[model samples]
Target: MTGGPATDEATEPYRRRIAEIWSAALGTPVTDAGHHFFAGGGDSFQAALATATVRREWGLEITVQLLIDHPVLGDFSERVARCVDER
Candidate 1:
């Protein structure tokens, strides 16, 4: 808890949102951080679509390669948060 509860709490919504996006893209309920999008029957095309959706939904600029590089929702969210913070 060194990061503080407030910081942790702030990340929760982002995590949940990313999870929802992942679930929607995969067309299944996914609640685990270990879930791999591509391994779970998602293709590059799907990843591209998902990236576009995330960009539009989150208002963050992201590329399909970024989604492919970070397939897990948690990782993607962390990356996106970093990108947002940098901007």
Candidate 2:
């Protein structure tokens, strides 16, 4: 939430992958990491689906509350990358 979006070379992969998952879950093409998931027609169910997909694909546990906290794709992806790195 501070500085610019939490995106960089390190978090790019997570941004892209999470975007793909979000696109599938929301049934919309998500091209910008700046796009907010909820603003882009996402709901609780879609968030759950995306979260599950992320967990299955990356073996990382991301909660819906986390998603809600970081609704922006870039921010969420950065958090995901951090979680992966921490593991």
Highest lDDT: which candidate?
A: 2
lDDT, candidate 1, 10-66, per-residue tens: 566777877777778778887876678888878877787778877897788789989
- Screening candidate 2 with a backbone cut-off below 3 angstroms (N, C-alpha, C), the clashing residue pairs are none
Give the per-residue Cα lDDT of candidate 1 at 15: 72
TM-score of 2: 0.90
TM-score of each: 0.80, 0.90
Report how far residue 76 has shifted in candidate 2, in Å. 0.2
lDDT, candidate 2, 1-87, per-residue tens: 344434487889888889989999999899897999999999999999998998888888678888999999988988888899999
**lDDT at 21 for candidate 1?**
78
Measured by TM-score, the strongest candidate is 2
